[model samples]
Target: MEDISIISMLLTAVFVLGCLYLVIIPFFKDETFLDHTRKSHTNGATKEALLTTLNEIEFEYKMEKLSESDYRQLKKQYESQVAKLMRDEETSTEKAIDRDLLAEVEREIEASIQQKSKKGGGK
Candidate 1:
């Protein structure tokens, strides 16, 4: 009896842990689910890196280490890339805001319906 009870307890614990792994783990592990903050951090890092490289190129040119043509070419490329990143970041932010607004609207609609149903039922 003691051995059976121990085995049953162990099996229950394993089942619970398996259930948590299947259900709860995905919420924590899903990188794209609610990751606006991470996106902004990545954008900041990319912007900073581009600016740093551009400055380095300028410094090199000032030191006469880079030819004028090469300096201008690199500067133009980095600036364009930076512009694209900024545009993409803005778009992503807008999308996130839209999603939040939609969710809020849905909740309000649901609440209004529930309230109407309750009032109707009470009458």
Candidate 2:
């Protein structure tokens, strides 16, 4: 399949999932994949944007623009986003560790090959 079609289908699946999550899941639940990236700080962007959004959220709460329940709910959302960013950071760290381990194994194998060749076992 074409790349665009793959992406379209993936997005459609995500939309369906988001609708279901919004409809059925209770508050304080996990977010979807798209939400994870939208909430990601992997780009090294200053957390200034997030802090700004949170300031706005706090203002809304303080000004009585948000009901107590709504304020709590949105605060949960922002907190969840921060949690997701941390999780993403942990995931990348884990991935880098795995890659380092793989490279070590590859280097060992290459050294073994060179040793064999030096011993005149190479064709």
lDDT of 2 by residue, 21-83 (tens): 998876566768657676555434535555667789899989989898988888788777767
Per-candidate local distance difference test: 0.94, 0.80
lDDT of 1 by residue, 1-123 (tens): 999999999999999999989998776686774586787788899999999999999999999999999999999999999999989989988999999999999999999999999999998
TM-score of each: 0.54, 0.42
List where candidate 2 sits over 4 angstroms from the true fold: 1-42, 46-48, 59-67, 116-123
Clashing pairs in 1: none
The per-residue C-alpha lDDT of model 1 at residue 80 equals 100
The top-ranked prediction according to lDDT is: 1
Residue 76 lDDT in candidate 1: 99
- Window of ten residues with lowest summed lDDT in model 1: 25-34
**Positional deviation of residue 75's Cα in model 1 after best superposition, in angstroms:** 0.8
